[model samples]
Target: MDSGAGTAVGEMFDEMPQEKRARIDAGGEDPPESSWAGLHADALGVVLRFLPCLADRARVRAVCRQWRDAARGRGVAPPLPLLVLPRFRFASLTPGGVLSAARRAWMPPGLDAGNACCVGSSDAWVVGAGQAGGECFIVNAFSHEVRRLPHLGTYDCSLRKVALSASPESAPDWIAVAFMIRWSRPELALWRPGMRSWRVCHHALFAGHIDIAFYQGKLYMLWKFTPCLFAFELGDDEHGVTISRMKDCFIEKLLPTTLGSTHELSCNMVEWHGRLLLIIRYYGGYQARHRVKVKVFVMDLSTNPSVLTEIHSFGSDCIFIGSGGCKSFPAGQHGGVEGDLIYFGPDHYNPHDAFVYSMRDGRTGPIFKPLPCVTHASERNLGFPVWLFPKE
Candidate 1:
């Protein structure tokens, strides 16, 4: 019996062999395309982002038609990060929002959408869900083109979180979609840029409410019900998703229930001043007559527990004029504009007003710029605003 066991082990060893194991350990050789023209195109995109002005972006595009084509073609390139801002037509009845340019000093071309629920912008591509039919569309806000992606699942999906990532060195690009199943079970779904199918990711800890952010070739998601965070390395073995709890300074104190207690917390993972930050907000509570207050907090994710810091706090008095009267609302979908400036969806506290806050300026303002796409006041309901950050 011992001899048979030895023979079985020997057979297994013989099948493996040293050279095969060596190649496997070395991650194999890269394909020739890794050093191709795509790399140059990608580098040029970075140049366009940091250069002083749009003229520089155009000048670089004019260097060569290939560069121009590459720059233009990169409308959906996943490597470049983009900030997608949803602008509502100030004149429509239902008033579906239009995606606008969020560049640092210059605005990019504008794109439109129908009943967009939530948006995830990466590079120059924007992925969002439509409220009319729960359909998902992959759009290039720069090119003004929209492509329909294959339906991943149909459960009246509430896509609360969306993130885009591209493999370093011009590899494949991927889009990660996350949504809740109403009252039970949230899911993580992913699709390659050109592929039509999506694979549902299975991880025990990912089953609760969570938010997603992509950084350095991995997907970072924060569970809302708990203070736990999971990072999945993309393209690591059939792009197999492996999750590990992130240990940080402020993570221990995240306090799961705090997010839901005051207002619907708007959690965003963003790069600020060469470091990553998770921005969260508590929009305040009501005690008597629809009085609402909002507080903005910032957490530097580079440290342990992600240290939490408060930016500003403000309060407002609200009166309900509707038959239903004074109701409390949570923090709606939020978008970061101009690097540090944060924009929020409409608030019931000031139902007829639009709010914008600039962390750099340390000031909040009521939006009065007559938006061509959105109505000044909507009797139906307050419009939700989505802030798009610059992808430069």
Candidate 2:
């Protein structure tokens, strides 16, 4: 691990109790100095495997020379998804379902969270843009490393969402896509690493509030109310810039009759297990705390006409839905229950409350406990919780 990585792990341990550190140092029993140093490399690798948390792994590496060598030789699994809020703060959801504040000294200098909005997250990098100045940049939340990108001009405030094709660590050909709403009309923009300016695409079909996702080398956008989906191929050629409508991919037809009323609706598009999933959220009352309902649909593009199928079960996969973006991960991977379940409530206005909806059995309840950092009075002032996956 690098020095920055070691510092992050040390910070996490700083919050732990001295008694806990003593227990870890003892390693269950007193052992001869030679015996501890004589442990085989393979044996140490086995111990490191169980320490899935990055902080835990880093702490182990700092224990001694032998342990650091063992950690360097072993492969570490990706860290669990973290919850990121404004002001450069992070919280991790433990396997026991408790939300704990993570160590904070990883933010770069002058990285203002008040005027910044996280539009996208990929490969552990939070793609953020200045809401007032049209400035765009990428920052590694854990490493405190920052990469400044070209500004998006005066349309930055209009930018509602952004997605990255690949992480900067992977390659320099990575692309950043942004969906902006100007004058109540939506526009798509693309920027490559070496580009001098963003390539803007304005079309009538891009109108209305929408959500964007990059999956399988293609960019997808879904209009909030309508079932229309616009697909764009990602490449450097002119044809790659053109937006094509997937005529057969209509979602409104699969919706229940109860959704056709005057209720406000928000739709999210997510790609999981090589399939496109659409989640529709229905808001009832006109007030801020409105009654909410949700529906899940998967698009069957293999069919001759690409029909939308309403699924009541997600099997072993669980979906995380929030204003930032929707993501699906294996339930067992995170010690969560299997079957169709939706974890919702990363709200900017109501961060203290989270609800779990079970589509398999049709039940809803408060499963997500509020984090200590978010208070009812400060909820409106703080940024919404954005889910983040540590970089590989």
Candidate 3:
């Protein structure tokens, strides 16, 4: 990975855990064949850049001090997301035909990714309530840096969904917005990494909010009941986050032409090319095994009332609707995959299932599992799997 590929994961093992380092030291000096560690810096860079496997690259970094230094802050961006599954197991999505990469020790000492309630994600961080302490936190998948959130009180992972305003590496004001249940009523929790507790905000208008996204420093919410769109600052001062019911962007600005009932349909709000796009999934019914169809629309906020324009393509860009948040990527640059497609699920009914949704034909293809029987897991046994996309 180059600097643009991000430094977080590339330098993940720079500060190796004590025990693991001791084990490596216990093995004593490596054999003569281990002289690969002394390879020239330029040569090391070329090798790491061309290495197809993330796990192999990580191993090369762990070889010796000189190699570790070269591997630090450099490498190719993972072609696809590392399939984050229970017990910290990760299956690297290596595009087509190539072998998948494996995950080494991916966490610090205490976080239990197996039981952690992963709510949302932005960039390379996974936001969720850690299983060990029942406290909420944002953990960097590569660096294993844990920024704890405030007390969850009685609420846990299954009841909420959270998002970050911006990545911590690029922005210090890492505001977190969570739409969760509070005392049987829908509530909004806002906090930064160091906050003592979340700023609990309740808006009667947002009771029906179905999904949320950060757009140009503001929080935009989609309400299913009223077919309304709401926006407010996802920011803070010394006093903490500020919210007001009076700041509704549009009381009846229906972003979707015909909003579906909560049970029959679901939508994800994605920020695409500086414009917010809404992806609606028609699952047919509550018992439907497959999605009937999918639709995409660009929310033309440039207009007075903000018209929703149905679009058939995203050019060379594609979107990932994950458990945490919707991600848009210029996929063509990373791999040979075309744009204008969406990767959805690890389906609700079948945990092993996922689909590629093409907007052109409004059809679905099976989501890549990396390998057969790799992603199969009991739905209730652990936290749901998610695609952890890398970013700085």
Candidate 4:
């Protein structure tokens, strides 16, 4: 017999004495090889950018040691800006649901006083305050970062009406916060990303019935009294402030509006089609009788005088404001890129459910569950939802 055959025969003879013969299977298995050998960080970063949700990206890190290292190395690249949605206080949305990127942490006790309100979010950081007179805090859930702004001062009577936004064109990044002061004046504050404190600019014109929005590189203040928009640059220079009054800019002034009035209707507070928008919830039809009816409008700024164009209205029995519409406790209001998505807290639902509506995909997906301590009830109250993005 050949040497190989002889070895095999010898092995069989060894077991033959015990009345058992071992059999060799030539194609039974293949030797192991390292799966991580050729992995690249750049490729991993591309995968993370479109992960749909943050939790899934987190799962990739927990897979194994090699995967964790690869993911960590890839994560160092600047991540695309994430939109934040705040959860309400006291009640939980779901028992063990996933937490959205915004609700990752709780407001500090010092800042979470009973009257706290989350005004809005910018670039993954949230701008909130304790009602009108309460202190303002910018909370970054991801970095576990928190910074308190200067006291809003008694000038702002109705804190609920304040507007918080970041300059859309600033390089290093800065937050532009504007608050209405009832009869006196409005306060415009600037919070630079790395700055230790906020700077305030008091203006009497902005105190009138108006809405504030940061667009391009200027702060656009919509005056409901005169019904005009004032564009102010984000700097201390006096020449930076420019006032462009719209002639006959009042088209739908008679239409019922909420929080503040805008001729154009949009998703809560977002302008979808390059125009300010408002969503009017009408009730009457069978679908609207029980649930809320939605009407959307877009503003025509190209016209010599701005005008609101009614786009479309949908009556749905599905999107109830407080009922089975969402699984999480609803907090403040909801806003997003026009026609992109609509997000809100299901304040009355369990802590686990996050309600999101996407215009592009035409579907809503649950986001994340809050960590136990993060969802606990506190003196701080939660308001509506706002999209936070890094300064562009």
lDDT of all predictions: 0.41, 0.63, 0.63, 0.41
Candidate 1 stretches greater than 4 Å from native: 1-118, 131-134, 145-148, 166-171, 180-184, 194-196, 202-209, 223-229, 235-250, 254-266, 286-340, 346-354, 358-363, 368-385, 389-392
TM-score preference between candidates 1 and 3, better one: 3
Instruction: Compute the lDDT of residue 283 as modeled in candidate 4.
Output: 33
TM-score of each: 0.49, 0.75, 0.78, 0.51
Which ten residues in a row are the worst by lDDT in model 2? Answer: 1-10
Task: Give Cα distance to truth, residue 379, candidate 4, Å.
Answer: 7.0
lDDT of 3 by residue, 1-392 (tens): 12222223323333454455555557754434465766888788777655544555666777775686676555554445555544445555554422253343346666655566666776778776754236676788766788777766764323356878887787886788887765667778788756788787876766634677788877888763344567785545686876643355462445444535543556667888788887777666667747567777777765676677778898877788765577787666554555678877542223444667787777777655344343455433444556677641
Scored by TM-score, the top model is 3
Error of 2 at 370 (Å): 2.9
Better of 2 and 3 by TM-score: 3
- Model 2 C-alpha RMSD vs. true structure (Å) is 6.6
Overall local distance difference test of candidate 1:
0.41
**Candidate 3 deviates by what RMSD?**
6.1
Model 4 per-residue lDDT tens digits across residues 335-387: 11122334443331223224445434445555333333323455223443333
lDDT comparing candidate 4 with the true structure: 0.41
Q: What is the per-residue lDDT of model 1 for residues 225-264, given as tens digits with 9 covering 90 to 100?
A: 3335555655534544333333323453654454456564
